[model samples]
Target: MTSTSARPRLAAGQTTDKDIASFLAHTEPVDALAQDGYLAGHDGRAIAQQLRRPGLVRALTFSVCHSARPDTDRFYQDDEEEAAQWRRRRTQTIRDHCAVCPVRAACAELALRDEDVHGVRGGLPEEKLALRLATDADRLGKARAADDRVERLRSVRLDAEREVHRVALMHTGGSVPAAKRAENNDEVRTAVQERDAAKKAHRTENGWTVAA
Candidate 1:
């Protein structure tokens, strides 16, 4: 806050005085993020104020910047434990304030757009928001990464299987046919089998009887 005070404040715009002065006088490239499909949705103007106010949003972002995973769980994890209990109590206050707020989407858009912003954006703040963001971002990242890896590995496995099928077709009149070989190379079938194998192993290792 003290650090940010020197940054340029928003000039009164053509709209009402109540509208938030921009958080950044000029929206820097670093400050802008992929908000097209990212924000969870909320009122823009009202939410923007919460973002502009420096306390909870700033505290949570700072915590995430220092965190190992750059995620919201850092808020609850308590490295900011100097005032951990106080911080948790403070979260409720932020929530109460946000509850009265009419601009939750604006807050969410600001958070999503600014990579620097983390944790809960609107009605929630700090660890409450952080935990959800971490879960969502982690799940999305993991799934996308897994999909890429699966695609690459699928090509490798399919090429190998094709070679075997080709060799069989050449050696035996009908040992392995082109149709079965073609079906095995499919993305859905291979991915499903791969997922199943991984799940089975995970379940066994975790001592679970059901497949994940």
Candidate 2:
């Protein structure tokens, strides 16, 4: 039997920019950064989701110093550079909160899925790299686990291979044989490793650290 994921479902909506600006301006912040004079997660999503429905990302989000980053719209508290540096460190504060956050994966999927998320969002530049690296590492781990299972079932590899074949044929609307599965496994492993290596190269080019 197939099992369903219990994770919260993504919803569709068309929140507008005006609605967002009004939302932020009118509603008071309720998150940790509230005392520091900043909007929270939903606030960030409220603005992004106004343009895209899946814009609801829950990263450790907060504003930075007006001077340190140089593009900040306004000051967080004081005009001092020290205050800005304190604001800069707020990124780590968000990540520390994310360590305990229940929906970290869902939050990250939202950001990565969105192509326009530049600058600081949930965490700092490097902190976001860490989150994304952790995510990629997790997915790769699942793939590796599947590989390990096939290795351990060396004797009954045919049986497991047959199941995979049946499922693939059913999805592809074609015939397939477990007897031919051994060759297919080798091909799949090659393709996966190549793709993974390419991605790693790209990550390195951009200076984003990928996990092992």
Candidate 3:
């Protein structure tokens, strides 16, 4: 995101022909932006004004914001359950906002191009965007085949880990602390060990040489 201070701030409801022209010059492709109802309720003039204002443009076009929310926390979460809850809430919030946004298509394209983007953008969380890019790249015969393979393995690993957790909870009467202690319990321990083994095997199959 670029600084808005480079251009003079516009007064409330104030827009000049020059500002509109500048916005037009920097505008993304209209046809692409218009697809998928991105511009459903917006007209040319309103969109031009939004584009001219850098601050407003970023706010409306991007998912991350200064406002406090479950999504505002950095992605390096220490708690898996909390992280999953936050991601679900954040994803829904972003999707709802993108539903009527005028620049959603542009946002989505940028997100696909930058797979490392943090936070949600264009209604997709970082992982989802990576999957989308990998899928698209595969369709286009791009060099993202490895990424696609890794992502698939990652998904399997996640599912296996969840299943382990489920088994652990079931063995521990649904108490997380009890579940942790259940590592000595054959059922819970077996589930965890199996998940770990499967994850290691999948990574090895993908040519990952590092120790798990």
TM-scores of all models?
A: 0.24, 0.23, 0.31
CA shift of 168, model 2, Å: 38
| Residue 26 C-alpha lDDT in model 3 | 40
- The residue ranges of model 3 lying beyond 4 angstroms of the native Cα positions read 1-81, 138-212
For TM-score, the strongest prediction is 3
Worst 10 residues of 2 by lDDT: 50-59
Query: Candidate 3's error at 70, in angstroms?
Result: 12
Candidate order, lDDT descending? 3, 1, 2
lDDT of 2 by residue, 13-101 (tens): 52665554433322322232223333334453343222211113222232232112333332132456485575655555555554334
**Shift of residue 2 alpha carbon in model 1, Å:** 44
Off by over 4 Å in 2: 1-84, 119-212
Let me know the TM-score candidate 3 reaches against the reference structure: 0.31
**Candidate with better lDDT, 1 vs 2:** 1
- In order, what is each prediction's RMSD in angstroms? 17.5, 17.3, 21.1
lDDT per residue as tens, model 1, 3-33? 3444444565635433332232113111231
Candidate 1: list runs displaced more than 4 Å: 1-85, 118-120, 138-212
Q: Cα lDDT for residue 49, model 2?
A: 25
